[model samples]
Target: MFKNIISKQLYLLSYLIRWTLISIPVSVAIGSMVALFLWLLNWAIHFRFAHTWLLYLLPVAGVIIHLLYKLYGQSAERGNNLIIDEIHQPGAGVPKRMAPLILVTTVITHLFGGSAGREGTAVQIGGSIANLFGSWFKLNEADKKIILTAGVAAGFGAVFGTPLTGTIFALEVIAIGRIQYNALLPCLIAGLVGDVTVSAWGVHHTLYHIDVTDVSGQFYGKHLPVSFLLLAKVLIASALFGLTSMAFAKAVHQVKSIALKVIRINWLIPVCGGIIIILLTFLLGKPDYLGLGVDAGYPNAITIVSSFHQGGADFFSWLWKLIYTSVTLGTGFKGGEVTPLFYIGSTLGNTLAGILNAPVSLFAALGFIAVFAGATNTPLACTLMGIELFGGEYALFFAVACFTAYFFSGEGGIYAAQRVAAAKTDDNYLKKIFSKYRP
Candidate 1:
């Protein structure tokens, strides 16, 4: 009996080891290609001549956005939502054309100065690549799911250079209260490979820059008690950030709902949305809120946190981001809203930090993950992301804040097609609520 058990364990272990060796490099390669395209696209928008043609761009851009949506929106409807759908229904894979549609639309959005994120574009491209592999391998339903998960990890890891977080994101995103342990090895390998590949390819990924030279180990040793208080504040502030994120999501849904009701033609949705965005930019008298807003982080334009001081950049800039993102996404303009969520969280957290005299980097990191947790309903992924992007020094604080944000944000998710794969965190409440209002 003992020999039989040992033999079985050895077989399983060997199988996993072999699989990890093969999958990681392949997945990472796919992810790297996706990242290269995304980086090139973003660079073109930010540095190429496109940025110089602001005066005559709006109306022409509006026409292009209108035509793209009218012709391709329905088939492309399932980009983010489709990924969520596949998590609930295991055998599913995103359509082949979804990647091209998203890539084209996203490039158009950036070219025209639409406020959005790049992850969506990268993920779709990766998914499209993985989908081809799945077909070639003739993978079973379970294997297909593994491929999908690896693709997500690879894509995210390539962009963020945080393999652990990307791996966790792949496991956490599919289910509300469950993860597939069997899928971990492939996801981890893919994430690591993707990160290494992107780094090799000269992409400038996002990372937090903090100046901690002033604080010493003695300070940490003597002020160990202060860590708890800082964490406590982080927890409370993160919850507020989560709530605000929920509010932003609700606002988008409500606005989209109203727009659909008023404008029956599908093309008009993007047209009207583009017009609103253009009008807002003109009224604001600048283009600071446009695109990914990474330019906000360039040089010393005041971090989102410093905007909170009286007559500082915080209040209006944050509000403008909120309005611009809400309108741009809510109006059927095709793009990813995840990066905007980051901007929102960081700005809100920074504003709060300025008020409380807390460490702005600490609060900014917390807000970045907390809002992501609330928006995606993936607490573990959010926590991992904070550690990966900022560093593990505040891992405990990130975990606490992320879980709090996840709990307070409730059952709603950013992706409408995301089904409840498992029971909610609060089973009884979820059951009751689900019974009353079926998603």
Candidate 2:
């Protein structure tokens, strides 16, 4: 029995060591590619802002992007969903061309003032790179899935500068209530290595701060720092955040369906979308809703950074961003929804703080991670992300907000390929909710 136990332990240790060795090069490649993508994204955003006239040619740019995909990007067009599906059902390997295809299209989308995010591009790059390496090594299907998971971890960690959260996210995101523990080691190694590699290239992520001093005061004779009232406000705002996530997901699906039905010419769909976005920009009298919405360094810019302060964002800022992003992506634009979701959640949280008379930065921070948790149905990952992005001073509040939002966000998510390994509620209740949204 002792020899058997030792043999099993040695086998496990050998397995871990082998995968760790493989993950090093995979993470390094993903990190380097993501760093380049981010650098180009920043340049594209700045160039668009400087020109300002590029917005007028959005439709033309849209047409060219449409042709690029229509001609040679059919497989790559599936984006992150393709990666998730491949992990779940390991079919033909992820394509090699996905990397350049998404990188160029996403940059073009941003260059022409399309409202989108960089996460999708980075993730596709990682998946493509991993798939290429897997094919080169002649990996089996099971090993291919594991490498793909590691690729996702590398991309997410490098892009957001959150290695632990990225590891958990790659594990948690495939199924609704289950995690792929088998990939944990490789994912962790890849996430950490990817983040470090990106930093080595002089790439930096955005910064966010929360003032915990006032909110940490004792209340009602309890030693706890967070107040009951603040917790209550978090609950209320988080529910709204969840509902908004559902709405965004539903809107994207509905818009795509409607656009496809209403338009006969496939290529003209994005052109029409570009025209609508341009008209909306003129109507709104500002371009704040365009691009990444992280920070434009311009006065009166409404962005994720702006949402942390009073009067930094308008009450309807979140709604407009939702509409803009949904339309931009639904009409066949290339980009991720995570950053735009951050914009929506933070801005909505900022609006709610004024109504609840709570701390603006505190609630914005809660909504930041909570909405993402709800949208992705990964509360644990989002909670860790909150602690990673902000400090752990408000971890309890982060947990409360993230878990609540996850419950309220419903069965649907931004990734339709994600399956329900376990239901959040009883069968009857979940069935009722699904029925309402089904048709």
Best by lDDT, which number? 2
For 125-225, candidate 2 gives per-residue lDDT tens digits of 88899898888877889999999999999999999999999899999999998999999999999999999999999999999999754655465666766
**Stretch of 10 with least lDDT, candidate 2:** 212-221
lDDT value, candidate 2, whole model: 0.91
Question: For each candidate, what TM-score against the reference?
Answer: 0.86, 0.96
User: Which residue pairs does candidate 1 place in steric collision?
Assistant: 305-350, 307-314
CA RMSD per model (angstroms) = 4.6, 2.8
lDDT per residue, candidate 1, 177-284, as tens digits? 778778898888888888788877777765564334122223545744235556667778978877877777787898789889998976677677777888887897
Name the TM-score of candidate 2.
0.96
* Model 2 misplaced regions, further than 4 Å: 216-222, 428-439
Scored by TM-score, the top model is: 2
